[model samples]
Target: MDTTILIVDDSQFIVDGLAAILSRKGYSPIMAHGGDECLRILKSAIPDLILLDIMMEPMDGWETLEKIKGDPDTREIPVLMFSAKKITPAEAKEHSLSIDDFVSKPVNPAQLIESIQRIFSRRNDIKEELLLAEGKGVDPSLIKEYGALRKSIEVDRNLLVVLRSAVGRDQAGRTPSPDEMAAVRALEEKVASSERRIRELQELLARTAPPAGQQE
Candidate 1:
């Protein structure tokens, strides 16, 4: 894969291990041993994704994250918090808007991979119909609706991830309790609604597209 991931950590051991896993999974990894190095690397080369450790000396992950997000040049890169630190619900909620995702240390390789894949799917894979409709002369309102639906889908997906992580059951091959199941189901329903609206938008795009030789 051409996708490059920058892995920033204070520990060489963690960096090396993560690099190995990412390499075997077909990702090219750029390594940085500290927050300063990570920022310096960002100056010259921006990777497709970043795995940032949260507990560094001098500059912790939050500081680094704020700097990264504050910079217009590097703000758009998806960041995943790779740390052993327990993220309390409040911290997670506060940072949810800033982070693409997080993978707690004692890293479950499967969970890490899944989170990366989901982020890529969400951020990188723009809907073909959306692109085509934008290129055509679709009504601005229609395009706005499509954007809203896609955003709704993204919100629901994020909620699903947070809920599953909080319950600590989805990935363990164990059944979820009734409460967890109910929450998951509600999110799933919202996702389904958004998806259905997206399909309708696609069909409307097809119908409303300008005729051949007249598209502008």
Candidate 2:
């Protein structure tokens, strides 16, 4: 449920700065110094979104993105091309299916965050569309409730990510501050509750719908 973002850049400064910014905003940010490292990380873990730097040594962002899209395991992860270089509309159209969005270099902090949110929103909409397409005669309101609960879980998970950052739990993974401990406990509970509701909604939808050939 945690929204983990992979910040792929050749420059250590950029990756670190972006990671700091994202962590402060309650999103888990993982750093990959170049295309190779990014591919390596993908083999083990798939982040929710990838902020890919276009210019790099040895393998550029476009090549890296091609490899990413070529692999079935990693193909579906959304990518936002980050670079200082200007891309033409023709180029954008050429790779439209490969990447979700693009951001020029020296991104505005507020606008960057907004862009990331928009990407996630689009992902949610796509998921809802797919689910709805598969579900005939399922209550539209019920699907909406499922989506809302899923978003609630994501929020709680982000809060947990924030608390982890606050206490440096990722490194030592030991005792946390009392306040953080309490907050983490509450978030865990909230996430669990939302997950349970999602399951219930799933079951309800499954039961209320007619078989594939039969119309409601």
Candidate 3:
């Protein structure tokens, strides 16, 4: 594979061992002695994955991970941390840190490979979701551009129903003023606008789709 992995650890022996194993597995391994160097290297290159050791001094793996996720540029890169301290995914989630995987220190090669495969597998699942969405007669662009449009339409339609009920009478059973009727009309227009946009997007997707029998 053309995957590049970055190994960050204060221990030279650990870094070297992980690097050798990754290289033998057909991955390009980049080494950084500590969190500082890791950030410096990231300024120039973003690796496909990061294997971080949690026992570094001053700026430990958790700190490094926080910095990486805080920055929009590197937040999406998957991070896997290993240490003898036994960090679990549930524990990581409690701290609001997004760790892709965790492995125990004195790492077993088989387990390490399994963790990496799991991370890649999750990514593949996301791609499959997007493909399925596109297959359901929706434009990929509309999926992003109008991402919350459907939910928003649902909410507005519900409001329209409530407003219509209020138009004929109030909570005390009195006739609604002209302003209440105007409010109902406004909500009706909003619902129509969303429905019109959805039709336009569906039409656009149909036009852009390849003709029948054409190979992608």
Candidate 4:
């Protein structure tokens, strides 16, 4: 079955353009002009994925994403945010938004398609893990731990982005300011801590996991 993708953007041009791209890639696109409309559509039918724009009337993508993630019914659906405004990893970290991915505009067709495919592939892997655990009579809490680890990894990766941006030289090739350097150091420590936690989680899951072809 062709995947259904929900696109929420205030601009008709962007909505139409993204819809065209996804259609050619063999996906059905559902369009919403604003966050309210997107939430309304979601009440009746949840799409396989959502391509959301950060800027919109009455409700921005941040608020909309919060609502989606907060809801029990729609929280699992992956959302990819696209925007003309540069949303730095620092901002995303501060907001604590559970975004699957971010694509900056104007959108690159190949990158957009690749990101979408990657997300679907990851979700499929998680679903398979869930099925395996169920068959083996493993504790369901393990699956929840896996999901939490994934989110932590994503957050840390974004922090790395912020660190990179902070350390980058200015347009004139001048060195980063002292404040920027300090920020980079702080971010580095956070990323290191997160990486260590991620490793611990992976090892725990592996040790506790059922052996191949074995069922409890």
Best by lDDT: 1
* Local accuracy of candidate 1 as per-residue lDDT tens digits, 1-216: 399999999999999999999999999999999899999999999999999999998888988999999999999898888778765444554565578777778788898999899888866455555666777878878987886576456655665676667756556767767876676676677678889889998788778856479866
Task: Write the residue-wise lDDT of candidate 3 on 144-163 in tens digits.
Answer: 54534544464455445434
Cα lDDT tens digits for candidate 4, 1-216? 779999999899999999999999999999999999999999999999999998888999988998998899999899888887766535555553377777778999998999898778777777786676566555678667666666556645654563455457333576877766666666667667767876775566566656567745
Expressed as tens digits, the lDDT of each residue in 1-216 for candidate 2 is: 779999999999999999998998889999999999999999999999999998898889999999999999999898887787655323443554577666777977776788799779967774875476356666667766776565556544544554455555565757767765565576677679889888897777666756568774
lDDT of 3: 0.73
Shift of residue 101 alpha carbon in model 3, Å: 0.7
Residue 75 in model 2: lDDT: 91
- lDDT at 74, model 1: 98
Candidate 4 whole-model C-alpha lDDT, 0 to 1: 0.77
Question: How many residue pairs clash in model 2?
Answer: 0
What is the C-alpha RMSD, rounded to one decimal, of candidate 2? Answer: 15.4
List residue ranges in candidate 2 displaced over 4 A: 137-216
Stretches > 4 Å off in candidate 4: 88-90, 130-142, 155-159, 162-188, 209-216
Score every model by TM-score.
0.68, 0.63, 0.61, 0.81
> What TM-score would candidate 4 get against the native?
0.81
Each candidate: how many clashes?
0, 0, 0, 0
